[model samples]
Target: MNWLTNWIPKIRSTKSSSIPENLWHKCNKCGEMIFKQQIEDNLLVCTICDHHERMTAKQRLCAFFGSEKCFVVEEPKKYSDDPINFTDKISYKSRLKKYREICDSDDCFLIGIGSVEGKKVVALSMNFKFIGGSMGRALGNAIVYAADLAVENGIPLIIFSSSGGARMQEGMFSLVQMARTTIAIKQVKEAGLPYISVLCDPTTGGVQASFAMLGTITLAEPDALIGFAGKRVIQQTIRVELPDDFQSADFQFNNGFIDKIVHRSKMRSEIIRILDILD
Candidate 1:
């Protein structure tokens, strides 16, 4: 047995590298190993299973704007970094700093002006990588900025929502954004500019309750999660087991919560067509 154990080490050493690390991503839904470049070309969707992967705000913007440069709108000023002086395992200020460095973004909200298929539009997207895309005062202000920009320019506005909820560190101030953003969207509506909302995966919590659902036409990626609460929480509260597809974009579309469930491949063309028609 000792000799066999010694020989096992030698045998293992003879094998090739087992680490599946470089330029390949395993699909979370379908468990398919796909090349990174292929996934990027496919808009981060799995080729075999057609699973839509989560995208960063920057990636989503680039996809919509194509290879050309899109002018980014200046985000509104943020409140104090640690409004409540919030602290848990780590301080809120420190966490913000860390996440900013990790995500390479000032905040979760990214506002910009970009041409989509030659139609100029005002755009805002949530960066879920930054603290789960929690909506704070900065994001709320950004939404207002985008809305005002659209209203002022008489251009269409599009928002990509991929948030977990309101920023807990900001407390009530964060929750206040829900109302603020809704009001801003209402202003855009009153101005007669189209406000399109694209809900990405895991659009839930305070975000779903507000602007994420207030689009002139609500569209979601295929199989993306869209709900106010988690399945477990809802089931526990309602005292019933949830459906297999509960909170999914398909489920939402079937139930009329979502206007359409667009696949990533068709998203750009669809948006362009809709913009043309609306224009």
Candidate 2:
């Protein structure tokens, strides 16, 4: 009996296995259970519903430009990390530190230079993981730098915007970025270079009001939320019921706010096609 008990213990120990975290993902749209690898291979889109998931700035850049062909541009070193010394339960500097560790980025915006089909292009991708991709001084500087770099290299500029609007911690500094980024986009347009804007999930607030809408060819991912204000806010303000799909990519395209609805899989080719046509 003792020998039998010892054998059973050994068998139980051998049978036990730990499942790693993040091995599976649940699609928010369709509630489909998908393997993490499968979702990533599909560019984070849901296999069943084709719902596009939010991607990190670096992920988007690598996906669009090919990791081997992309080079990151450093963010400006002079901008203040906490301009207004804001504090709400936690200091702004502390919040920045936390998100920096989480995102491994200096700010919400990331700039990179890459070759798309052998044509040089400067791209700016916003990281919504970092404080909702809030527009701030650093982001404004990065936008200006990207625009200038595209102009200098005689290349096109592309901006992928996914933001909740302006950073409230930065106060007026954040609000002013809308104007600054607008001016930067204007500079790119003046240089006669293409400035393509790709609106991703939840592009709203000051971002949509400014450069996100000022693209030479504005593009949006399927089912992306694009608008100046949220549906609830707009409805409350206007005192009218909004459409069921208000501010969706399809809705915006129908209303002529967006030029096209692009899928993540076909985005690179579509951009290349546009570049070739413009070239």
Candidate 3:
């Protein structure tokens, strides 16, 4: 049998330009096309529509640091690789290997310290683009370590939650992160430092069940999804249709699950206000 590679085109032409495409992402609110780097500079907010797009953990840290002068707390590197050799529709190891080569990150979490609006704050961002932002042991460790560091420094802890929930590859190990992260947030709270969690689009599953819900002042992007379980799953179990905006930021705000619903343009001011109030 001939391999699929045999059918590939033999004639190839090289382009003259080498510059990468200035990629653009559309805003869900006002349907505006935003430059990726510009959006990132504005804390992932669409400049035209003020729509907030969820960013990678590293990107979030960079924005927090660039916007506010602060230092970083270097946490230990996290673990990666398939623990159980898991396979669903695809092989976990195979997928991991491919992404590893592409993204070069084994885990989905990154923790760093920075100032938000001139107030010292710790940040933890969940990289949703990486394996759907699945939380593994290293991610859990980063969360715990960040929380502990915040407590040690007597500063606020801020976490950007954007995840598909626990990593299927880690099995029970991933499930344990829920508790690990929650306990870490509590550790910060016990020290009397504010714990602010930002719920980005699709903050659900293990993330919503843990520290995302326990923030001393929880803030969510306009129209973010925040919930422990999905609406469809809940509806199927309860045999009833859910509200139109179930698990949305509006729903969470109305139900008092979150402190406020802030737009991307107003996020900096809102965070500063929270810091002032806490101070």
| Highest lDDT scorer | 2
Ranking by TM-score: 2, 1, 3
Candidate 2 similarity to native, TM-score:
0.94
Model 2 is weakest, by summed lDDT over 10 consecutive residues, at 68-77
**What digit string (tens of lDDT, one per residue) describes model 2 on residues 33-73?**
99999999999999989999999998899899877447666
Better of 1 and 3 by lDDT: 1
Candidate 2 displacement at residue 257 in angstroms:
0.8
* Candidates by lDDT, descending order: 2, 1, 3
The collision pairs in model 2 are none
Clashes of 3: 0
lDDT of 3 by residue, 1-279 (tens): 355555443322123244447678778788888877887667777788666777766766666566333556466655656777788988987877776676556657677776765687777877788888877787888888888888888988888888888887889988998999888888898899988888888888887788778888889989788888778899999999999999989998999888898876666678788889889
Report clash pairs, candidate 3: none
Error of 3 at 203 (Å): 0.6
Better of 2 and 3 by TM-score: 2
Please name the candidate that would achieve the greatest TM-score relative to the true structure: 2
lDDT of each: 0.88, 0.90, 0.79
Task: Write the residue-wise lDDT of candidate 1 on 67-134 in tens digits.
Answer: 43766655676666787889999999999999999988989877778787679998888888999999
Residue 18 CA displacement from its true place in model 2, Å? 6.4
